[model samples]
Target: MNCVLCLIENDPIAIFGLKKMLEKTNYVKQLEVYEDGEQALHKLKPHLIENTPRTPDVIFLDLNMPIMDGWEFIEAYTAIDRPQNAKKILLYVVTSSVMQRDRDRACELSAVTGYIVKPVTKDDLKHVFEEDLQELWKNQ
Candidate 1:
């Protein structure tokens, strides 16, 4: 249950709500927060130098932000020359965008783990866990 996660969001209310839901799972260990994708990139880039457990297990990325949006982040992140063992972030597009186009766009991105619409509840988190995190949990 030592799932380290990150939240790259600008709105304080959304951050608080997401944090509250994540806390309820009792799975997340370190929950890092960034105001934008730029901040997240700045902090996470160095970790890509090598496969390190210090990196986050999952990143709940918002599509829209003040500086450097999700698409920009995905482009930047995928460009990095990561070592083979480096733990690639399981990036999930967590957004309010309900348009089919948005989901299709997210699906087109190879780096994206999945697309999740907000306000993300505990059930959503549970479903995500069931998808892959359950295997990780069992192995742990």
Candidate 2:
């Protein structure tokens, strides 16, 4: 089955651009966009709690946003109690920030799988899926 992806970003242009780029890939079957971390956490909680099949397989998070930022979202999400066998969600920090601190901070978070600078290319998305598929195969 194809994968589902979630995007937590506020910039409309970035959202539009990502949607276009993601559309170019064949593995993504669904894309959910959240304006900020709070909204994302609220909306995603049920699926997460239930361990639903619709739970996103991947999340592309942005650092800057109104109300709740990516950092806050990561904190909150990681705090949630999840089943040991719950579907894994690979979260990538997709932001314009190139600061070493930002990269280091992202790496410190266990929930974060990778970090991508702004304007994620189609190849990046492809690589993420390929890596995920490889992981799944290894586990099986």
Candidate 3:
């Protein structure tokens, strides 16, 4: 299976850890990391404009960043017009913030499929890939 994964965060360590976790997973083939939401959005826009099939399959977004936070990223991502075959994109909010408001806001986004806390582990990825992802795969 072909899949694209994106990690957007200002922290390099967090990005590296998430990328490593995904690398150990069976589903992810390509992974992209961005330091901020604006950079991610800028990079993704051209791909969307070209109707690129390589657009990320899943996005792990951080609530806080130097430029354009996760909320802004969601707004931009949702506004983009993608091709029919562009990939089944799932957005997951992965952040250190434990505030209920943040969690609630993340869940409120239509594009967001799940919310995960910081220090994501292989087990978490496994559950998402094996269990939650099964429904989407079956539909596909």
TM-score of 3: 0.88
> Of the pair 1 and 3, which is ahead by lDDT?
1
Q: What is the C-alpha lDDT of each candidate?
A: 0.83, 0.88, 0.81
Which residue pairs of candidate 1 clash? 51-86
User: Residue by residue across 1-140, what tens digits does model 3's lDDT show?
Assistant: 46677778898888777767666666787778888999999988877666466577678899898869889989988998877776677789999998999899889889999999988988778777677667677888
Ranking by lDDT: 2, 1, 3
Q: Give candidate 2's error at residue 22 in angstroms.
A: 1.7
| Position 54, candidate 3: lDDT | 59
| True-structure RMSD, every candidate | 2.0, 1.3, 1.8
Q: Lowest summed-lDDT stretch of 10 residues in model 2?
A: 131-140
Candidates 1 and 2 compared: the better one by lDDT is 2
- Candidate 2 lDDT, 105-126, residue by residue in tens: 9999999999999889877887
- List TM-score per model, in order: 0.91, 0.94, 0.88
Candidate 1 lDDT tens digits, 1-140? 77778888988999999888876778687888999989989988887676556678888899999789988988998898888767646788999999999899889998898899989877778877666677655664
Error of 1 at 95 (Å): 0.4
* Better lDDT candidate (2, 3): 2
Identify the runs in model 3 with alpha carbons over 4 angstroms from their true place. 49-53
Count clashing residue pairs in model 3: 0
Model 2 residue runs over 4 Å out of place are none
